[model samples]
Target chain A: MRLRFRQSLDDLKEKLLVMAGMAEQAIQRAIEAYRVRDTSICDLVDRGELAINRLEREIDQMALDLLAMEQPMAIDLRFILAVIKINADLERVGDAARSISDRVRELQAFPVADLPIDIPRMASLAGSMVRKALQAFIEADAQTAETVLSMDDSVDKLNGAAHYTLLTLMKKEPNLTPQALNALMISRSLERVADHATNISEDVIFWVRGADVRHKMGEKPATEKTGTRS
Target chain B: MRLRFRQSLDDLKEKLLVMAGMAEQAIQRAIEAYRVRDTSICDLVDRGELAINRLEREIDQMALDLLAMEQPMAIDLRFILAVIKINADLERVGDAARSISDRVRELQAFPVADLPIDIPRMASLAGSMVRKALQAFIEADAQTAETVLSMDDSVDKLNGAAHYTLLTLMKKEPNLTPQALNALMISRSLERVADHATNISEDVIFWVRGADVRHKMGEKPATEKTGTRS
Candidate 1:
């Protein structure tokens, strides 16, 4: 029975990792769709969303069933709880991708222009954070999780800069308002993706160390030396 | 032992209700702040946010402890899980309030012209949905929960109308782009509040009927006829 429980836990971890991978790919694809104005990529993202949603439900059921059957305690209990939280974050990441894809579709319908800023960099940072957060979970590396958290600040700064720049652009050229607004919305969507990734990293740290590190922006995380910069 | 478990469950429920009330009030106050351009209300919303965050952590701990100690099955298990999910939704509602307050501050700084539509109605709809979701939880009334679900569509329509109006306003008077953007962001924040409330109502339905009615939006909820919808 103990062996079976361990096997189930491992299975749950594997399933979660799979979902994480799918979510990360969806974000990447959505951003690519936006950068290239590739409606085909957006279509792919829209189709891929169903798979992500299904995986979320499956992982949720697995976590709940494990809790009911094994009644995991201590670290094991925290792992399951973190899985539930992270699963929700992953689903929201998928939602962000869908949001971006929708924006891309809208942009396709309108005349396209060369955006004045680098959106792909923002998307890259957000995507990397999502990937690293999952790696932190798989490796149980608190340092990697901390890195994801610190990266969130950079994403927020970029989002603010994008907003300011877009506003200025709109002010100078009224004809560019719609396109600029679409770009701003895309930036916001990417920032939200980074936020979700940070949430997942926070869950990973909590699962590994049993510490609630959320909302403690200034305070040092419990696993500060592992990967945290400040 | 059973009585102790019951008491713990009741305690968790009470704390959640308090948090729900706090979030509902925060949304209402934030809207009032926007309408009156009262910076003090925004400050109050910021101060109240920390308390909401703390309550979220406390309720999370309580729910986890109950699950670990009582090993509740069936309806009891569903109730605890529902509390966990609802706790998250309420925290996010608090976040929506904070976002709205942030927009209020921006509006005060810019002093935009009068809005073209009724924003308070949007706020009232979102707040009432949250309140009704909580009341449904307290009474275990599926009908009330279903009503909240339907109201979400109304909020969505309001958001669409607001978005279109703001877009036209910005186009007609390009100088008002920043102000129009702030108004649009406020509307988006209110829409998010309503979405979270809808999530809470769905959780209530899941708690009562053990049915996953989230993705299956068209079907009538299992407990739809029993309770009065107000």
Candidate 2:
């Protein structure tokens, strides 16, 4: 029974990593769609969303079944609960990808001038953070999770740059307002994806170290950074 | 032991409702601050964030504790999981409120001009949805949760209106681009609050009925409408 329970937990983790990969790919494709003005990539995002949604439901059911049947305790219980919360975050990250795809569709409908912003860079950072967070979860690597946390500030800086740049562009060339606004929305979506990644990393830390490092109210205890990368 | 477990779960639920109330008020005040261009109210939102963050941690810890201690099964397991998910959504709603407050501060920094759109109505709808979602959770009213789901479409409509109106205003009155963009961001924040509220309501339904109505792929038999108002 104990072995089966452990296997069930591992199975749930594997499925969550798969779902995370799907969300990350959707985000990557959505960014590419923005760069190439490719509506076909948006179609890919839309189709991929169905799979992500289905994965979310499957994971949720597996979690419920594990709880009902095995009655996991202590760290196991925390793991299941963390999976539920992380599942929601992953689903929202998928939604953010869909949001970006929708914005790309809007930009296609209304021909817009080129933006002087680093939107793809922002998306790339956010996507990397998401991928790293999942890898940390699969490997139970607290150091990688911490790295994901540190990258959040950089994503915020990018979002701020995107915001101010769009504001200035809108002021200078009012004709670019619609496209600039769409680009700003895209930046916001990427920022949210990064936030979700941070959430996943926090859960991984909790899972591995049995510590709650969220909200970051107190000074984090100084420790030599472990070189754990998966 | 079972009685103590039930009590702890109830306590967690009550605390969640209280946190939900605080977040709803913050969202309401943030909207008022935006409408009135009150920087002080915006500051209130900034200060109140710490409390919301702390409540989120507290609720999360409590949910995990209950799950570990009680090893709750079936509906009980679902209830604890729902609390964990709903707690995250509430914290995000607080973040949306803070975003609106930040926009209010930015708007106040600039010279006041004739507003380009109806933002308060959108904010109010978002706030009401948050409140009603909590009410649904407390009462286990799946119908009210469904109502919250339906209302999300209305918020989306308002967001579209806000965007189109602001885009036209920016095109017609190029000088108002900065202020118009700020208003657009504020409207986007309101739409996000509604989205979070819908997420909470969906969690409530999942807790009560064990049905995942999230992506609209699964059709569960609707429960009787518990028309309870909080």
Listed in order, the DockQ scores are 0.23, 0.33
Per-prediction fnat = 0.22, 0.46
lDDT of 1 by residue, B183-226 (tens): 88889889889989898898798777653432242354222311
List pairs with backbone clashes in candidate 2: none
lDDT of 1: 0.82
Model 2, span A1-230: residue lDDT tens? 67877897899988988898899999999999999999999999999999999899889988877776554545676678778878888998999999999999999877758888999899999999998998888777899999999999999999998898888888788778789889999999999999999999998887776534322314542111111101
The true-versus-predicted C-alpha distance at residue B15 of model 1, in Å, is 0.8
Over B110-214, each residue of candidate 2 has an lDDT whose tens digit, in order, gives 788787578888888898899899889989899999999999999999999889998888877877877888898889988999999998998888887763432
lDDT of 2: 0.83
List the lowest-lDDT window of 10 residues for candidate 1 chain B: B221-230
- All candidates: CA RMSD (Å): 8.0, 7.7
Which is the leading candidate under lDDT?
2
